[model samples]
Target: MGAEAILEKIRQNAEEEAAALRRQGEERAAAAAEKIRAEAAADAEALLESARRSAEELSRREDLMTGLEARKNALAARRAVVDEAFSEAHRMLLALPAERWEALISRLVLEASETGEEVLEVPASDREKYENGLLERLNAALERSGRKGKLTLAGAPGKMEGGFRLVGPVYDVDCSFEMLLSLVREENEREIARLLYPETRAAGE
Candidate 1:
């Protein structure tokens, strides 16, 4: 063959080889890029799932905290109501009218006079009520009830709220309004709660 024709053939073969090499490199690069894209998509999906789980956990914790706070507030409110009810009752008893108060004192004195000879220690505020007529009335009631009517009032008044104390030789009996209510409260706190919260009682039952 001629030299020019041989050289032309050699150049054409070299060009075809270069084009095949370029095509192979491009295919390999495209495959690598596809792999990288798939990996990135999987990583993004995993991150999204983790974030969703975290958000759900945080939401649940918040809801639990809110419920506990609400329950605490409700319990506090209920306690306040019960306390107010007892306070109102105490105020009413302390403000009893004169005639009713005298009768109550007489009744209490009669009940407390175990020996009927105990010294009656009354509050200074109520000393005049007993001195005027209550002491005589209490003695008569005690005598009628088959006890010695030898009760005497103490010279110095006692520290009391709204009742008297019987100071005997060996023991003493406290019949103050505060004492009476405290005793009643100790025995009947649940009943009072039930009356104020019938729904709670019904649920418990």
Candidate 2:
């Protein structure tokens, strides 16, 4: 062959080799780009799943708090009702006949005769029953004790409840309805609160 023809053939082969190398490089770059795109898609999906899970957890917590608040309010309302009912019942019991008052007075006058001729400061509403039934009992107790025979009734007005207050020369004894009510309330406060607010009581305990 001529020298020019051989040189031309050599140049054509070199060009074809260069084209193949370029094609291979382009394919490699496309493969790398596809891998990077897949990695980015996976990362975005993971982030979205994490966000969804957080929102669901928050919703559940909110629902739980709402239910707890509702229960607390309902318990408070029930406690109020129970307190009112108890108060009414206590008042009604206090307004009964003076049978209990006469018994209490008999006990007090007996004790008083031992010390001195003690006068009782009783409720004005019970004066009739006291004069009728309690006076004879008081005199008998005084005779038994061999003490002075003067069980005077106080002219001062007091509670209408069926209890008495005895005041002697040196000492005094209070047996009023108010005093009894206060003692009862103090003793039952914890039980009442627990019964009314069981859930809160458990948490506190």
Candidate 3:
């Protein structure tokens, strides 16, 4: 062969080899770019999932807090209603006529006189009633009930709304309206609640 022909053949072979190497390098670079893209997509999906879970958790917590706050407000409203009912009862009792109050006081005195020798401590406002022969009436009622006790009015008036305190030599008896209501409040509260909030009671049941 001629020298020019041999040189041309060698150049052609080198160009073919270079072209193959370039093709291989392009293929490797394309595979690497695809791998990087797949990894990036996976990382993005994971971040999105984490954010979704965090958002759901936060929403659940907010719902729970809202429910708790609503319950607290409902309980406070119920308490206010119960307190108002008791206050109304007190007002009604205090609004009774003088004759009715006297009769009530007479009955209370008769019921309270234990040994018939206790001192009746009434409110300062009620001193006049005792002075007006109410004590005599109370004694007669006590005698009828077979209690051999005499009731005398105390010199020091009690600080009370209504009803009297029977002061005995041994122990004193509190028969004031406030004290009586306090003694029965726990039992009365259930009845009052049932009446005031029948829906709540039915829902609970």
* Lowest-sum lDDT 10-residue window in model 2: 14-23
Q: Which stretches of candidate 3 lie above 4 Å from their native place?
A: 1-67, 189-204
Give one digit per residue, the lDDT tens place, for model 3 in 118-167: 79899888788778888888887777878764788888999878777877
Query: Per-residue lDDT for 1-205 in model 1, tens only?
Result: 1222222222223222212222223464355335533433333333223223433444444445556676555445545544554455556666768886676666666655666788988889888877887788889888999989889999999897767677877556666666544543443445545533444766998
> Between 2 and 3, whose lDDT is larger?
3
In order of TM-score, best first, we have 1, 3, 2
Give the range where candidate 1 is weakest over 10 consecutive residues by summed lDDT. Answer: 14-23
In TM-score terms, candidate 2 sits at 0.51
Candidate 2 residues lying further than 4 Å off, grouped into runs, are 1-76, 95-101, 104-116, 142-149
Give the clash count for model 1: 0
Give a tens-digit lDDT track for model 2, residues 145-194: 78665677888856546456656554455545554343333434554455
RMSD vs true structure, all candidates: 44.4, 44.2, 43.7
What does the lDDT read for residue 39 in candidate 3? 37
